[model samples]
Target: MTCLFRRIRFVLPTCLAGVLLAGCAPNPEIATVTVPRAAQHVSPAARALLPDPNPPYTPASYQSRSLAAYYGHMQDKLLASGKLRQDTGQGVAITADQLTKDFIDIAMKDEYMRGGSGTMHRSMDSVLRRWEKPIRVFTVFGATVPPTERERANALVASYVNRLARVTGHDIQMTTRENANYYVMFMGEDDRMPFGETLKAAIPEIDPATMNVFKHTPRNQLCVALTFREQNGSPVMGKALAMIRSEHPQILRLSCLHEEMAQALGLPNDSPTARPSIFNDDEEFALLTTHDELLLRILYDRRLKPGMTQEQALPIVRQIAGELVGR
Candidate 1:
């Protein structure tokens, strides 16, 4: 059965090995696009809540540099061990039956549940959720992040969002923060404290527990996404917020972008059995996989509506999976 609640998904720093190493080079295509500066789009209301656009780069900047180095080292180790596969096409062959099961596990489950007092507890249960309205993604960056980095992030997100739209057949596009229903913020170490106010300004009804997690997310928790339903007992997602640690180096940051943004769309749970997919916690795939594209297609398929119980959705999911896999 489906349970209605806000869903928060976290991507852990799991390791695996594979070929097809993802190069750290920035995309030349995205670089050509003239990205609007993030500071220019910040609303007057949100401006006061956010960190300064040009704060003195000092202690926090130092910490962020250190973090970048550490994560860079970690990425090197992961690459050496053959983890973080960017070649999505070269993974284990997935069958129709396996795809169906994976869809149910990833799409119809809640990764974190909220207690009566508004604290989050790790729990698992059925919950069918997806966006009914068009998705407009807006990104914001912390003061410490440089202009070049911001441009790279903007281009990456824009390109990825378009790819997602094409995969899901959903109306997803990047917009200004003022007009976006989905907010993606890249915050550095110094921006942690002020991030709460920024979130409050953006979503006044945000849960304190969720804010706490964003403010003090553990280093191991690479990135997070929180999706809110229209109302209690409702399955339609109305808003979403994703916080990515700006300290992450390029590949890890892109990995976070792929997983967290996709999770925010609806697939909020990870399955160890999900092969060659970013939805799995194994970190085998650094980017969205061919398997994952099919999953998104199934999620937005017209036959399976939001709030559907597992029993109500599984038959349709299986059929869709078979059709997608040509079974």
Candidate 2:
């Protein structure tokens, strides 16, 4: 089974244009906390490139520290068991046929479906989704995240943005919140509830069930991404939000970043057969592998337009996969 926390919702709310609204009411407690300038580690060059710095962060609560320790221990155990492999080339060999099948499974399916009651249910069905517009990512740090960690997260996200753009040959860049349609938020335990309110304000169409998941994400689930399409049932995505827990250790945090951001790009489901790939739930790869990059290339290829059903895109996918693998 896939990781329960790796959520992807393709929503088509009535208010599409207001999906990324401005002027969210700030939480008083969160607004009062501030980070000291000396605590920040962002270099001058990176500072100029990144979004405006977050307000001074509050110290982590005892519960938050305990949770971090638990996650850190879990990561160490996984690494010791050789499960979370960072080496992309270490996995099983791949072929054109396998790539084609994996693409259909990962790119053309939904992991979670929203019912009429707004509750998310686990269901699988073929659906082609991809962004037609330029992807502008904005990062938001929680009040409990220290400045040094925020700097590291910002740099990691910025680097990954460039990497994805190169892999897909698409226009993807990091931007300020004002211009960004994709929001990548790093929320600590203390920030989750308050941030949910902010999200509701920014996205008024956000349903109660979705807010419940965000505010009370299970501990086993580390991160999630939700993408929104136009109201007319268009497959082209216009907005996306990815939330990464601040309690994760460096490696796990980076892993969440890799999978969630890439999933938001369109490959929203996991397949057990996907080897050397982060899209699988086996935790075999902690980073985006060579095979995963090929998947992204295929997804964004000009020949395969967004919204093409699996039956319609399979032949083209097979041909493209063959060319990619030199079959």
Candidate 3:
């Protein structure tokens, strides 16, 4: 299975695209009321450079609220990026069984979250948390990228944010302001390695040394994008970093944008078995799929909480997955 990172971009239905990107906050229209229809499933593009599990997961060192605030931020985001496809399909017909099967396979098993640098084995407790209360918004910017690349990056990211909001019914939004907690940026070749310093400067919680390893390690094997975070003990992801190789072909660039952006939302691991998904190493689909969207919906559902074990979450996941079908 040579995952092909095809060149593709699917245009959203005129009405839906307008509604999702319709207006700004407060009396929110797109994220609050709009629900895009689920289209049929289609097979698509290939691979991404997923983050290897390094340093492993360790319980946070004890710190008082004042000190923790001074020393740390949000919880860790699983780093996952992807290969892309020929086009963004309308969507797939994801039935209840398909939904549960894919969700369980992705959510319950350790194998699904495999990384390259080291093996990451975890208990079920980590699968649970999400942005239950906090704001979910992102702003796109440039690194060494020129105006044209920045513009293209912003547009591609905006499309996925709309798709993510509609599919999951979460309050995810895209903005041009400085308040965005999640930041997606395009990095030109010259700005690549040093971009980690830029991230550390903006959000001091990020370890600059780790960013160095991340940027350099992936370049050796192309098609890798990165999504890191500044998170505390809770499952809620506060700040995230998405970096795309600015010089990639439009298709691969678009592909990296889709995977890294989606992964930052909580589905951070890549499973080889995740068919028809960008979250898999197989690179079966370059663009995000209906199955992946349902996973997003399940993750943000009010019934589920952050930091739940597989033992605690399976039943609730099934319940939510049941209602999501044919909706």
Best by lDDT: 2
TM-score of 3: 0.64
lDDT per residue for candidate 2 within 1-327, as digits (tens), equals 112223244332221110001232121000000001111122344334543338578998998998898678767866765766787754578899999999998888655544567676665465577788899898988889999999999999999999999999999999976567777899899888876765643444456755676787766566766666643456677777778889999888898889888877888777888988988766778899999999999999999998798899999999999999877
RMSD, candidate 3, Å: 17.7
Q: How do the predictions measure up, each by TM-score?
A: 0.81, 0.82, 0.64
**Candidate 3 lDDT, tens digit per residue, 1-327?**
122222111111110100011122121000100001221111121001212112122232232223223211110101123223444433545567666666665543333221234343342223543454333455433334555655666677777788888877777777533445566655544454544444444444434333553355333132332322223334454555555555455555566677766655666555554556876654546677767877888987878876677778887887887787753
The residue pairs found clashing in candidate 1 are 16-83, 17-82, 17-83, 18-82
Task: Write candidate 1's Cα lDDT for 293-321 as tens digits.
Answer: 99999999999898788899989999999
Question: Which parts of model 3 are misplaced by more than 4 Å?
Answer: 1-84, 87-95, 108-125, 133-144, 214-217, 220-231
Better of 1 and 3 by TM-score: 1
- TM-score, cand. 1: 0.81
Worst 10 residues of 2 by lDDT: 28-37
Distance from true location, Cα of 226 in model 3, Å: 6.2
Against the unseen true structure, what C-alpha lDDT does each candidate score? 0.69, 0.72, 0.47
lDDT accuracy of residue 189 in candidate 2: 91
